[model samples]
Target: MTSVAEWYEKNLMLHRFWSVDDSQVHTEYSSLRSIVVSNFEETIKMPINEPAVGKRKSQIQEYVDYYSGAGV
Candidate 1:
């Protein structure tokens, strides 16, 4: 494994779970979004899946599996 630090440094970003990809959200409907929409910047929605999730076609998982296979 590359260690969490290496992976983070390469592909780190901040976003909210279940939040839309748009630049901003208007009021009133803002609270409708279940997850928080603050300055969260380390959640990966790419190259993904977690072992815990059983590889259900996730971009995040692919990235992890790829790096794990690469021996880093």
Candidate 2:
């Protein structure tokens, strides 16, 4: 999870459109970890997200808007 977040932080172009709050990322990661740990048998193979508050629009929200919904 940490590595994935780090890679996104360094390489994702989404940042160009919206600023990601680092504190939000940390909180999201912690929450995600707790969820994953609690459901060890269930594997999450696709992106699951909610629009996170930030300085600008949320990247996740932008994707949902562009696509009109979530995808697998």
Candidate 3:
């Protein structure tokens, strides 16, 4: 995905599902890291966060998992 998209997904998309109030702001490519540092940085860099208490499914994760596994 493009940098803009990545930024939006991490911030905007995730925020809708899980945000601390309405302040679901995400970085504009500022949160991104190179592959070499991504693993370490990704851990510390938070996204919008997952819903605190529910079995609610993330549409993005759901579709990706379904389509990717549908070959079976």
Winner by lDDT: 2
Angstrom error of the Cα, residue 15, model 3: value is: 22
Q: Lowest-scoring 10 consecutive residues by lDDT in candidate 1?
A: 29-38
Best by TM-score: 2
Model 2 CA lDDT for position 32: 17
Better of 1 and 2 by TM-score: 2
RMSD of each: 12.2, 13.8, 14.4
Rank order by TM-score, top first? 2, 1, 3
Q: Give the range where candidate 2 is weakest over 10 consecutive residues by summed lDDT.
A: 31-40
lDDT of 3 by residue, 1-72 (tens): 235335655654422222232124223221211111123224433332221222444443354467773121
Structure candidate 2, residue pairs in collision: none
- Per-residue error for 56 in candidate 1, Å, reads 1.8
lDDT for every model?
0.34, 0.41, 0.32
Candidate 3, clashing residue pairs? Answer: none
Instruction: Rate residue 30 of model 2 by lDDT.
Output: 33
Taking all chains together, each candidate's TM-score versus the true structure is 0.23, 0.36, 0.22
**RMSD from true fold, candidate 3:** 14.4
* Runs with alpha carbons beyond 4 Å of true place in candidate 3: 1-55, 69-72
Candidate 3 local accuracy as lDDT?
Answer: 0.32
Ranking of predictions according to lDDT = 2, 1, 3
